[model samples]
Target: MSARIHKLIVGLTLALPLSCGGSDSDGGGKTAELTPGEKLCKSLQDYVTQCGAATPCDTALVQDCSSIVDLLSEPFMNGVSECINRGEGSMTACLTAGFGALTPTNAHTGLAASFCSECAFGAPGCEGAFFSEDNPDTAILGKAILPFSDSLVSEVSTDCATGLGCAGSFLSCTQGVIAQRAIPESTVQCLVDNLTGQAPPPPAGQETCVVEGSGGAGGMGGTGGNAGSGNASGTGGNSGSGNAGGTGGNAGASGGG
Candidate 1:
């Protein structure tokens, strides 16, 4: 990557915090250092705050306080670095690009929760999410659905951003996780129960995803779920039923043929 990014990655860790006996010497870049995730997240929040570009996917919104911590990890930072290294524009833009869209199976990124709750939830349309008092079920639906982010990441990598974060939703275009039935059925039932009545959707997709996530848990109905999720534990679902079911399940149920 670039020299600046190299400094940011390796050297920043060595830069002592002012609190840790480090001091400002001359007029220069702020002496204190932030980890890669912190740096990227700060840049993202700043971009969202200034730009108001929280549309299809708001890069700054955090559904839970815990997720902010989750968002900052080495792999995720690497993804961010990869995006920047290859000449992507801004932090948020690179995030939208999936470090520049590598996975053909998933598209339209900005899937995961934002790191900055203040900037994200306080933005404009976020009151409808976790803090909602109108219907607690709304949050339930949200929580029920978005865990796709985890399973998706789990299925692909231990890291969240490296997998579904880049894809932008819980539902993959390849139908890998769905076919495998990676998500719990209880979560599916919860989603089905709440989706219709709440009037609002999940804060974002774990299942309902960032760009266009297809809700694939069991509650989509036996026809829907069985059709979509092959319950693939990798190759088992892939060859046995994953792709076949994904393609055939809906059509067979509808019986268009």
Candidate 2:
């Protein structure tokens, strides 16, 4: 939760399509060795079922649980996996309690807030110990984050404090976060340009909230696919998502794609 751990687990961070690639079988019917990303994806899916928070996003898209790959950070995943495996009941409950009914497309956003508590704030949580300083998710979220605004904090915190912001909707929480942006346009623009290996789209929010920049144009599709190709998934596709950035500020159930 380098970006906002407790707040994330405590209900501070996240938004994603969420998935890893389908398992590939070998020519002779032997299963090929699983890549690190695929292994983690399997583990997370298992955990989701184990916790009763299983989602059908990938299945709905026919990606077959391949969308939420790689996650935003390995460190983040490691920390979360460790914490969830620690036998804490609250963590398990947090998975379901933080958000309401989930859908395949918006599960990532909801899970982000649910994981905030132990993942970022608790002793056994991943909060400070993990979290990459600069990953696609953080880059996109960082651009939208606004720690300096008291009013924004108060407003977001009101619901987030309940460990359930956005009216018990993770998608709504993501949009709320985006609306509070303070990061510079140039900085976010740089993220799209270099990270996606493409020219950045128009900067989101002028100098305030962003559109996340790369969209489907890069990251998951273009250069970042180096490993993004059905792997652990960038920010789940492996980046914070130029697509989410595009909808981050919009008011609807569809923001934070």
Candidate 3:
């Protein structure tokens, strides 16, 4: 909601370069040794270098990049991975395919591949960064989905201070798109496999819930049936006594025994 956050989102969400037609032209061709994801990652790193050098240490751009890195790293990886697994060429490829699936001829759809690829893999410490930790699976799988900054914008609108909620929404949306556009049922299975390794403690309500009894002592007593016309003698006599206290006093009894 703050102006700073607004500026950050706007900067990150700016229109990105795109390349459609599935050709690896524009110097982004896949190397003989590299997977689609690796190629896309390299392109993203190149974009970041170009962008940073173009601005020469712009604070707003730096801040925006840092915020994006913090908020969207995991989602970017998940979405890209899912896209790769779903048979898309790479993350950029997947974005292109997804946009194509919805609207094939739109110029923006073709351009989205470049835009999303750069955004997804742009951050310094992110998976596709030039100095990133070594992880081939991440690099390849990360190619399957688009960047999730749009989802994050909605989240920031609601809670800008902590941005935790926005982060969660962005991740969830990223994973959801991966499942929807790329892998059909892989997300659930992947999560199940992950949780199987680490046995999480059961949730609070799943363990126990207690209820206390608070009825008065006499509250459970049942009313006696109407007295019969004849004399009655029983072992369990009513406890009522006195004019007011007596229950079913001999109202119908005659002068006889």
**What TM-score would candidate 2 get against the native?**
0.22
How far residue 14's Cα lies from its native spot in candidate 1, in Å, is 30
Q: Name the runs in model 3 displaced over 4 angstroms.
A: 1-131, 135-171, 181-257
What TM-scores do the predictions have? Answer: 0.26, 0.22, 0.17
Cα displacement (angstroms), candidate 3, residue 186, comes to 4.9
Q: Give the candidate order by descending lDDT.
A: 1, 3, 2
lDDT of 3 by residue, 1-257 (tens): 99999999777666333334334473467646654344334433443343222222222223333232332334343444344343333222332333222211232233233323343433334433311126443332222222333453333223321333432243344445434433434432333222122223224442121111122122334334343344553233344443343454333333234
Better of 1 and 3 by TM-score: 1
What's the lDDT for all of these models? 0.36, 0.33, 0.34
lDDT of 3 at 115: 29
Estimate, for each residue in 76-148, the C-alpha lDDT of model 1 and write its tens digit.
4456545544434443345433422223122112322331122233344443443243656334323322323
Could you tell me the lDDT of residue 81 within candidate 1?
A: 45
TM-score of model 3 (CA atoms): 0.17
Candidate 2: segments with Cα more than 4 A from true spot: 1-36, 54-65, 89-257
lDDT of 2 by residue, 41-132 (tens): 55445544444332232122113224322222333333333433443222223222212221212323333343455233333532222222
